[model samples]
Target: MKSYLAAAVQMTSKPDLEENLATASDLVELAVRRGAAFVTLPENFSFLGQETEKVKQASEIAHKSEKFLKTMAQRYQITIVGGGFPIPVGDGKVSNTALMIGKNGEELARYEKVHLFDVNLPDGNTYQESETVKAGVSLPPISISPELGKIGLSVCYDVRFPELYRQLSKQGAEVLLIPAAFTAYTGKDHWQVLLKARAIENTAYVIAPAQTGNHYARRTSHGHAMIIDPWGLILSDAGEDPGLALAEINPSRLEQVRRQMPVLNHRVFG
Candidate 1:
């Protein structure tokens, strides 16, 4: 694996599919112009709204989101991760999926988000993702690229589960992609800490894109889109806005961190 720049794109995506796609296009251009070889869009980059609205438009959302990722990848000649869109499964259910596209617009890896966010917060915010999303039954997949190293994929809530990332690391993943739409309620106290812990424990680079600002009624995201090095250092942070967090993803640094603190190697159990 070689040294390259990766971007974590933060956006305030609403229910409008076309508008969100346009925004993503501009962000992708920004990343490409800044010399990023790999760029990631946050979960719900295509659409973020009521679950029923999302479900109602799942087919259209999936189609356009996939096309946009492919088109952007081919046009900019950069690898991209477009994620957590609603892909209609059956019986009014959709799989929250992420697709990694290569420079040539070829699909490299696809991961359906396994963990669902189902919680009731004291701040009067309640999320029951399982109501519409079908949980992935298997572990996430890793894409071993010649230029990008081993890239593992996961979505928003999956970051809360260390075992998910542990499985990725155990499968030889060197970089972890955790794109999210983290709520303001939890993100303030938990987002960066969780991200750092994942990087530190896995000994891998973590690229996390996020959704920031208000998307709809009473639904606001806590945004600090960031990239963390294998040593758990905050390389770049895009704080509370519609922008990007850019950083260097270096294999040498990953190797160095692993040499100094081989946490994965020292793991006691599954």
Candidate 2:
């Protein structure tokens, strides 16, 4: 694989689909201007609002989000991993899907989020992701690009599941895209730690775009969009603000880490 710059964009996406799309486009343009060939936006980049509203507007969000990704990819001449968006699947529910598009506006990969976030937080935030999103059956898919290496796709809460990442790495994924709209409560303690663990264990570059700040109602997201190297180093971290984390994804560095520590080859179980 060839070396290139990748970007993880951080922004606050509201319930307004048009506004969020505009914001995401601007950030992608920013990354491209700064010489990033691969850029990923955070979860719910199209619309992050109340669950009821999301399901009601799932059709519109799906159409517009797909168009936005294609337009941005072709117009900017860069690959994009669109963060989780809602797609209608009947029965009054939607699937939280992550998409990867090539520079030519061709679809590269798609993964519906599997590990739904259903929990009661200590900060009084209870998430029932399964209530609205249909769980995916297949594992995360990987694309082996000549320039980008084997890139794997997964959405927000999937980061919490190491088995998913293990499967990806075993399937030859060199770079893992984990775009998220992580809640502030859990992210403060778990975000970076979890990402570092994934990178270290798999010896793969972890590119995670994230949502930051308040969206609506009692909802808030942690804003540290980050890029981690195979050596478990934090290459770039976009702080709690509307910005991006840009870093070089060098193949040599990845190889150096893997050769120095070959854990994936020694794994024993599924």
TM-score of 1: 0.99
How well is each residue in 87-139 modelled by candidate 1, as lDDT tens digits? 99999999999999999999999999888999999999989999999999989
- lDDT of each residue in 1-270, candidate 2, tens digit only: 899999999999999999999999899999999999999999899999999999999999999999999999999989998889999999999999999999899999999989999999999999999999999999999988999899999888999999999999989999999999999999999999999999999999999999999999989999999999999999999999999999999999998999999998788885
- Give stretches of model 1 more than 4 Å off: none
* Residue 81's lDDT in candidate 2: 87
> For residue 16, what is the lDDT in candidate 1?
93
TM-score of each: 0.99, 0.99
Instruction: Say what the RMSD of model 2 is.
Output: 0.7
Local lDDT at 172 for model 1? 97
**Model 2 ranges with Cα > 4 A deviation:** none
Position 89, candidate 1: lDDT = 99
Native-vs-model 1 lDDT?
Answer: 0.95
